[model samples]
Target: MANPDHEGDVGPQVAQREQRLSGLPQQVLYGVAYYAEYQPYDRLERDLDLMAAAELTVIRVGESVWSTWEPEDGRFELEWLHPVLDGAHARGIKVILGTPTYAMPPWLVRKYPEVTAERKTGVRIPYGHRQDGDYSNAAFRHYADRITRKVAGRYAPHPAVIGFQVDNEPGMELFHNRAAFQGFVDRLRHTYDDDPQRLNREWGLVYWSHRIARWDELWPPDGNTVPSYDLAWRRYQSQLTTDFIAAQAEIVRELARPDQFVTTCMALKRPAFDPRELNRSLDIAAVNPYYPMQDALTMPEPPPDAPQLEWETHSGVWAIHYQADLARAALRQPFLVTETNALSIGASHGNFPAFDGQWRQAAWALVARGARMIEYWHWHSIHYGHEQFWLGVLNHDGEPGRAYAEVQRIAAEFKQAGAAVVGLEPTADVALLYSRESKWAMEFHPPLATAAGAADRSSYERIFSRFYEGLFTAGVQTEILFAQDFDGTEHPVLIVPGLYVADDALLDRLAAYAHDGGHLVLSFRGGYADHEARPRTTKQPGRLFEAVGATYDEYTNLTAPVRCSGDFTGAATAWADALQPTTAETLAYYEHPHLGRWPAITTHEHGKGRVTYVGTLPDRELAVGLARWLRPNPDVFADRPKTVTVTSGRAPEGGLVRFVANWSWEQARLALPVAMTDVLNGTDLAFGEELHLGAWDVRVLLERPRKKDDEEGRPLA
Candidate 1:
């Protein structure tokens, strides 16, 4: 490989990243999941060639091959890896190597009892199953460190070795081992070692009263059923789980690219660990979401809103929740669709099923929202075809199937048009304040009200879904961000969704944004706490409430049918803020199912600025209408234009790239910014006019200038 200096052209390092955007190319690195179960070294080499020829430039090797790679334990096996990586690089494909963590060998889990996890029922779990490493045990880290440093340290400098995934899907399920449970207790003990009584006080449990005794008494409430106590314990367990992953990540980060990107591919339905905790240590987020209907309810036919309903279950509703998590994920840092069934599942048990063009379009929808990459769930399974839904492009024969051809065609299209779509961060008008610790803390707390209650679905998910689906469908570029994710320069206005707490830094920054005439909107749930997991009754929003021109009163938690109207629209009311309108005037209020005393939404003045709060649940109409009224953009794409999508990305060269898509049924003219060369066609187009975009055709205008720091949004090049 030629050591190319990252001067002006496509930076090789950025280009070598382990992902490529589905509709864009700067993200072209692709992965063919190569597991030990199918160690087709011969076919593997040939496959690498196929990937390169198709311009799919990445390979993700499994982390758990203990039974084979380290079959003798403590012994290293580079025999199988060296050629696999070298062969890929020989064909110009980069590789993201796993650290043998996904599945532990039977002997390792069997022999070292500490390496295994514990179930909530006090049963000791074992191996043969995958993702079974115990994070609590020092021994697990010890062994993990050895494998990581040994593998990563050796391969970090290699041209072929692009990145390392610590453990594939680290906490896919709850740790059901007593040792793992005991380890969590040990962590709590270590965190509060100085005072046992203080622990009891903070936890509101008097040990002598049998509230808690030995550490073993502390258990998470995730037995596929819930009790009040279990809820608290579950939250605690989640925090501990988070620490374990971070601890492992810290160890890996120390040895791997101090500057290199690291990410754990999240399990679709079973990513047990909080993504927020992992965000601190990760560079890119991997989104592997599943769309399982909520329950027995079938979807209504041809719904008034939303796209065509291919699914008719709680799965569709769950998909909204899934998308919300991703939308608000670490300020929505472009994530990878790490796992989507390459094809539909066949009626049989494990056979690979075929996916339709709809599936492909569904995937692109995610790309349009925020994902940086689109990685299929899997490549091959020894169980043969029909063993599982078709997650692979090739069947057991390793031959290109329909899925393979779809991906290949997509890849080729991207090759011609992707460069212009790189580094485009979402232009967020709203900062849905989300925090990792908040989620962990809330989940860990005992259930509100009483025992045997309905499950507490994430409200963050609710707000995100409403805002994301509504705004995105309208084709408005809005960002979902954490209060601390990026500076206000990235945005002129910031919308804080129900994250009611803030650190001094965030508070001060909000103050700064207000002083700079920035418009800040705080959702009903905002300003409820400080940085620490403590109530913000101190000064009511603690210290920053004054800057936002409002003070927190009491949290009025309500149920469904909540609405906010300007002095009075007839929308039903849920929860409201009994706020005293100080410098701020009331913009909207909760309507009468329960009225006047409820301030559903309010607006206030500050240093050349304004702050607004939505004190109730926002439906699509309110969200969009309010957004339009507040930070309205005059140059919005009128009449819901399709095929021609507008996007802006941060260029590796520190410039910007604006993308134009032609996802239309027929050739359509797209509004262009400059005398542009459609990177796809490699031809220049007339500037400042409507340029014809062909059906399903796309154009990328590169070398865009800096964005204007105004309401007009990122400027014309």
Candidate 2:
């Protein structure tokens, strides 16, 4: 087995070099996952021909079956994929070859039983599932490296192969194997500078008589009760995942061509993942964003009390944009949608495919938010597997269906638009701060409770999503900023919610940002704790008290909604802070007998700017009101109907590209604010003319360059 840190005789330094792919193709790439091997019969030629007819440009292949790639240890079967690649090349379709490392072969697992991952210290997870091994184990790494080199070496030179997906959705589980635990301990030792006392003090180990006198005194995270310890464990697990992907990417890069890229599919909500850290090592970021279809995509969405579906897919249309924005934020560049919905997407019982025209709507939405490629999860539905019911473009009978027709229309549109809309730089009026550390900490010590009174582990996401949804509802575009990457002046407004695990430097920076004329909107639990998940001894909202002009020493969990009055109307739910404002002015107050004494929202002038503090989890009405107040400036698409949404971005050729959609069954019309050419229809429309939109339809319009006389302040005819 090779040393995990070493790269052959070249050592660690050379292996650590970053080899990211710089640019992608100028046009939007559209296709699906083509599994010729998984087909019931030999249909490689026919599949390629159909893909060509659909105007598909690329197909991802060979990312799932490991046993087929290597039936026995040290044995390789590399010729089976040749026909598929050759057929695709003949049809002018490109390919993204995948390394089958995520799925371990049965023979390898049987030969090396110790490589199996343990859910707990000694409880090995049962086999017959994907990603069930401790990939950090030396034995597993040896075989993984061998197979990756063989497959990539064989196909890297293929004419149709354009890139490589290193692993399929890496970081699904947190391994608790002996080697993994030892690595965690070693990480702690280095982090604390080999000082046991420092680790003890930082982790607050004196509580419950848990102080460690030596490094070895640390117990496995399985039985840990401390929040700080759990935070450290989660961070270390994410680091392990990043390391694994980085190593595999390094292997593929060595075998790949200069034109071929290397990346792994990212499921953003995976437990043991950090996208920003992981993407630093890859060429381009890729994500699988699956969303609920049908009425779930409709605007003026179901009421708050509506019965929600229990699934892994995102719930609302705003959530879909949220996922795409997050993917762009990963490396601050355009990314790929490796796998999204084709037909139905989940278990055998779950089958709700998109309504007519929804595929086009979703594809345009993703592109508007910076997607370079749009690929479905698969081309044809599988005949047998755990995902057999996860339907595709061509269903079980292998005939082109509704999904295929919709995808084909989208592909032709992408071809027509060409380089005009690809690689767009999305516009943002507000910057929202995102913290992975804070999310991990809140998962362990949640501040909110479910309706059943159970601790809500998703407390961070709930708070963040409310503000994001409010911005989307109020027609304010947002840019997501990671805490470490946030500077003072990214946008006019910076909204931070439930940032409970920030260090002193970050808190101070937020204060400075407000002082430097940035409108800072803060919510409950911001600046409450240090990076170690230790509560600050200073007043609640520790470092921002001066900038905010308000402080809270007490808070409560509400059993019911509390009405809010003053500027913002609606109710506050789940939690509230008893804010004591010294220099701040009250913006809203809670309509309660006892809680009414403290303001529900307040604002204070500090330096050149102001800070508005929200003391409770706001209902949707209040959230939209607050968003409107924060970004009061009106744009061309302001005051549109509830069913109509318009998102604009800077195109690659330095022109404004706007995506106007009516997310409803009723036709809608929007009066143009500027002269623009419809990219899809090739029609020019004058300013103030009403543009018609069909139900569930989206139109891409490019703003025309102003005439010299118009630029000199003369009115255009």
Candidate 3:
């Protein structure tokens, strides 16, 4: 197959980056998942033509049709994929070939019934859908390896195949059969040095007559009521996913060439395991950031007194930005947007498609945060399947529409300034510590609920979002750091929201961070439990109580909204802690009828740094106040409107590249901090001059080159 001519405009930087192995794209990688097996050869040919016209540079295929690749048992008919691969290469598109292990062939499942995952009750999950196989089963691994190696060996040397997706969103299910449970027990025994006493003690298994006498007596987290045990089970399940993906990655590395990369996309919202841990084994990080814009609207209402969000809740690309930032941190490098809604449709609700320029805006949001590639969920809407209605770039008629046109516009933008965008590296001084362990603990037993007995399911997420949006509104770029990854030396200010589960070591680390001159912020119910979600055998906030200089003995689930008195005044809701400060200064207190004089917020100085403890969820203004207090002197776009967000990074050409985005419905006007050139429009902007931004619009500005003296670290003239 002869390579087709370049269809769209190609930038100089994009042309220069063609020889690179692994890094940010020279130009953006416009890709889609193409299912040639589902279409006739003639239709497939026409689709490739249209793909080239749309300036698509990459295509992911072969991952969806394992049954087509190998119909009979051990009968690998791999020749059918050759045409697709050749066609992609001929169209000047690289291929991210997938290991067909996510879904099992019917023959393999029929021969090995244990390959399917079993529920807690031992009922095997029926094998009609994808991701149904047991990740830890030895039999499953054997077949997974065989089929993966068969595909890898055949395509490892293919010129068009640039990388391999080890598995499709590897950790979406948990296998709870006999083998998996035995593996968990073995891991626990190994962790506790084969001492059942230590295991029972650490896990607090003596509660409710749940003590384990022997290692074998320990059960999988099926119906266990113990939060510690359930947390351990979830972590173990994550380990299984990591090991499963690693196994496939190792296989690919052994067969593929050095230039060929390996990665697995994450369907992140409810990941079966920690994605950060799993990405360590892969070459690059990728996430399917399904920004829940419409999904958020359909969500159940919160408690009557709970702080409700406005239309700005999920209107923008912060969901994408947040996930991309996390993915970049996980890989410690630029990552990829493996999948996003081409038309914003889902399985149940048919969401409205991208309106006008929203698609380009969302795409640029990913690029601004260090996404090397962005691919739509699929090329076209499937004719038959559960996701048939989840529309793609093309409608069911397979014709280019509004989304396709938007993508073309994005391709042209990349051709113009892809080099500048690709060269920039995102920087953030504010970091939010995130813990999956804490999330799991909250799931087991949330700290707050509604007066009518409705579970405040959004407690953890709400608190985190409150702080995140606070930082965003304060014009601070933020990075999400996991406990294992953060040592507190990277960011000057760190905020941890609702850290319900933590180890003494982590608590000590937080204290050390404050002692070492880092500003620390802790929210309500933080440090209340050990790493396993067991109540720490100490005071609330546990070992870090000294660092925080405050201890909470009593808390309340707020039935009505309350306001704060003292230093900061704002509405508080959901929960409040009766904090007694020993060496800390009270920043705020509850002004309620009965709760008056109770400390709502406190701050303590430790060594060269300080720690601030918030006892309840503060309203937006108060959250921003806390942020402003933590980051005094106003370096970033301070005092900016809550609807505006600023993300700044070092541009490829030397100076800073700032992305100013307005996610609100009303027009926002902000003064430029410094004179700069708008890269998006090639217009020069003056310092301190107010610039207007229409709703949902963004401006990418490159800071003007500094003076020669400034370059030498001299004072500006």
Predicted model with the maximum lDDT: 2
- lDDT of candidates 1 onward, in order: 0.54, 0.86, 0.76
Q: What local lDDT does model 1 show for residue 194?
A: 42
Identify the leading candidate in terms of TM-score.
Answer: 2
| TM-score (C-alpha) between model 3 and the true structure | 0.90
Task: Return the clash pairs for model 2, or none.
Answer: none
Q: For candidate 2, what is the lDDT?
A: 0.86
Give each model a TM-score: 0.74, 0.95, 0.90
Per-residue lDDT of 79-171 in model 1, one digit per residue for the tens?
A: 667777788778877667666766677767767876776564455565546666666667776776676667766676667765666677666
C-alpha positional error of residue 369 in candidate 3 after TM-score superposition, expressed in Å: 1.2
Model 2 worst lDDT run, 10 consecutive residues = 1-10
Q: Could you report the Cα RMSD, in angstroms, for every candidate shown? A: 7.5, 4.9, 6.9
Task: Encode model 3's per-residue lDDT on 1-717: one tens digit a residue.
Answer: 112222122365234223234533477687888887765334878888888888888988888777877898788889888888898889888888888888788888899898889876488998798888898999988878888899999998998988889889877777788999899888888888999999878877778788888877776666778877778788998999999998998998889877778888887665477867887767778888766442231111122332222312332345567777777767556778889868756654546665465677677778878787889988888878788877788888888888788888777777676668773568776778888778777767877675686776556777787787666555567877776665555567889998988887888888888888888899998888877777776887787888899897888988777988777767788889989999999999888777886789999999998999999988867876777676633553664665666787665566677777766556788887677788867999887788888866678887777676553233111
